[model samples]
Target chain A: MQKIVPNISVDCVIFGFDFKQLNVLLVERKLQDEKTGETLIDDWTLTGYHIFEDEDFDTAAARILKGLSGLDNIYLEQFYAFGKVSRVDSPKDNIWLKHQHEGFSSRIVTVGYYSLIDNSTVTLQLQERNVKWFSITDLPELGFDHQEILNKALEKLRSKLRSEPIGFELLPEKFTLSQLQKLYEAILGTTYDRRNFRKKVLQMKYIIPLNEKQKAVKHKPAQLFIFSRDVYERTKRERFDFSI
Target chain B: MQKIVPNISVDCVIFGFDFKQLNVLLVERKLQDEKTGETLIDDWTLTGYHIFEDEDFDTAAARILKGLSGLDNIYLEQFYAFGKVSRVDSPKDNIWLKHQHEGFSSRIVTVGYYSLIDNSTVTLQLQERNVKWFSITDLPELGFDHQEILNKALEKLRSKLRSEPIGFELLPEKFTLSQLQKLYEAILGTTYDRRNFRKKVLQMKYIIPLNEKQKAVKHKPAQLFIFSRDVYERTKRERFDFSI
Candidate 1:
């Protein structure tokens, strides 16, 4: 076991985009109440682990995520640090925590990170640890201040999707413009005029059209396009109005 | 004295705009080498303090800044957490650390925060602490990973200026289009085409043109403008190109 450093932790909010809605990973724990000796709610928490004395926080995050998802080389960005004094180990919250893990001590300040993942690339053998995926709309109350961390991560993700070409992280390697539009609408929870989105996207010099078409679609085959990072880096315009 | 929380600290990168260049507040410390029995570099550090056991990290940050600069209720936002296991207490850096702090036992994880300020609004009565503003360009080597923190904060600030109309944080209540353009150039370290910048800013609904003009100038008096937050909040659009 890694010797956990005192008063420090790392919590990760893993964002996975399915075909329709955005999803997040939460680890479920079954604990017995310390006072009542009764089983408490299987508290859901972000897939978090305590930082070791010798490990970088990001390294700890990657290890925890890899241990949970069996995936590596995921692009994780630090969003915010949730360091409110009342975050955890409160009189009311400590009992739930004491039942969850051993060697509970002083308050912990967590560094929150968010990773946007392509769901198709993740393995599905996550059965031993009671890990589950939930839609962004519906989530149970998480342990500690995890709900706030998840919310902040989602907020950062939404803002990033607007300004950065990171929306591609949530899409496949090759995607139709319609798929791209649907991804945005699903994450932003808003509808867009088809003509406006198409017109605006066509103006982006980085999104290149390929000579590929959908083979098994019922409707008319839409042309596939790939985001070219080279073009984006070379011909990148000032992103003064990404949200617009 | 506040009971300091061990192994965790908060360092603030206070950014001030003085019309011509961006400046950061750094506190200087005199340190002695433990083995050589000689003084080491009088290294500069950010306005920082250790987290108190019961206080919020941000609250500690504000209290430290308030204690250091006598400023209150100032807005400070967390940008990143610097958590390398070997950041401090190494043989190479511990000499400076030994002289500057007390009750130091282990490595620290510092949460970095950046705030933009109009220089005139801050109090100038900072006497006891060896605190001074250094232009971002000519800063000496900062101690304990602070240089990295400052760079990350600047990157965040530049990105923020593009996505949001935050440049006004560095300008007066009323400013000319030229002053606004200069502020952008100073912070971003880049220039924009004069006509293109004017056209783009004029397109913004929040930049209200005033009947007022610059007084007592050698050249023709140019019209001044004010950034209307009321309009920005209400007129926010998809920021697909805020960098323009």
Candidate 2:
């Protein structure tokens, strides 16, 4: 058995961007009263686990993500540490925590990490039915402080999207400009003028346009573009603002 | 009695800037053997303590900062959490850890916070002789993983400096343009062309030039300036890059 720290845990907010909306990967948690064997609470939450005694927080986050999604080398970033004393204040959550851990401590400090996954690129070998993706706009009641953690993760992702090329991590290899705009809109929670958005994005040398176009589509085929990591790495400093 | 979590700690990298150089606040730690009462290790380390069970991490960090520096309302930011299994791998550090806490866990996790202080604005009621300021360029070997913590803190500070107006927290209310340029140079560890530096800073509408000059000085009196929070808040979205 892994020597896990009961008081400290690592929670990951895994974000996957569909062509239309931003969705978060969450696990369904069902709790039962140990004494009465009565169902107490059933809710969804960000997938997380207590960290191992000998592992770094980063390693623990990666391990948890891999174990749950069977995806590796995802873009993971540690955003915040949520250590509110009343993090597990919900009576059901408190009871559930105590029932799950052998020596559950009253105060648990959870480190929040946000990860971006290109779902189309890799098949997620999810072995469990309880784990599923929910649109950010429509989320169920989450267990513990996972809701707050998810919110903070989204906020961090938005800010990073504005400054860094992390948005590409959630995108497929070949995509239309409309898909790119929709991705930005989904994450930022704002709609941009189509003409202005294209003009701004086109100015960025890193976003390389390809001659290839969509094949099997009812509507008019649009040109495809791929984000060039080499170009971005070379000229990332020259004001690549995506705040619009 | 206050109950503190022995396994978790909050270490602060308190940074102060004189007109000449950037300085960090560190506390000298002295350790001795329990059996023989022999001096083992004596070195400087970031000032921090285990967090109280009932308080949030932010509250604990603020309380620790106030307790140590006698200064309130300082700019404090949580940068990262340092959790390595071998954080106390040094034999002397291991012994010291066991001596300090009654039930010291083998593995400890520490959340790192960085604080900015204007040394000239308020008198630090440092009740102990162990704490002192050291220049970033000239520093003694720190204890445990404090050196690594400080390095990460500095990296965070530099990136924040490029984007935010946090550098103002370290300087007096009224400062000269030369002092401002030197402050940037000290933190960035690179000298900038004076004319270009002044030109870039002047373009920003926030760094307002006051109709004032130095009163008592050995050299020529330079014009004074003050950072306008109101102006910054109003025009912050218009590219407030301080990369120079």
Which prediction has the highest TM-score against the true structure? 1
TM-score evaluated only on chain B, model 2: 0.91
Tens-digit per-residue lDDT, B40-145, candidate 1: 6677888777888888877888877777667786767788899998877555367666655687656888888787777777775566657788999899878777
User: Which candidate number would show the highest lDDT if scored against the true structure?
Assistant: 2
- DockQ values for all predictions? 0.52, 0.30
Which of the CAPRI classes, incorrect, acceptable, medium or high, describes model 2? acceptable
Q: Which CAPRI level is candidate 1? A: medium
Q: What TM-score does model 2 score on chain A?
A: 0.91
* TM-score, predicted candidate 2 vs. hidden true structure: 0.87
Please estimate how well model 1 matches the true structure, expressed as its whole-model Cα lDDT.
Answer: 0.80
Point to the candidate with the largest DockQ: 1
DockQ (C-alpha) of model 1? 0.52
Instruction: Tell me the tens digit of each residue's lDDT in model 1 across A1-244.
Output: 7688867788889988887888898887666666898776567888777898889988988887788778888878889888888788544367666655766466778889887788888885476667888889888768777888888998888877777788888777898898888888888888788999888888887888999998898989999999887788787665443121
Q: A1-244, model 2: which lDDT tens digit per residue?
A: 8888889989999999889899998888887667999889899999888898889899999998998878888889998898888898888887787676678677789999999988676456566547888999999999888888998899777866765677878888888899988988898888889998888888888889999999999999999999888887877653322111
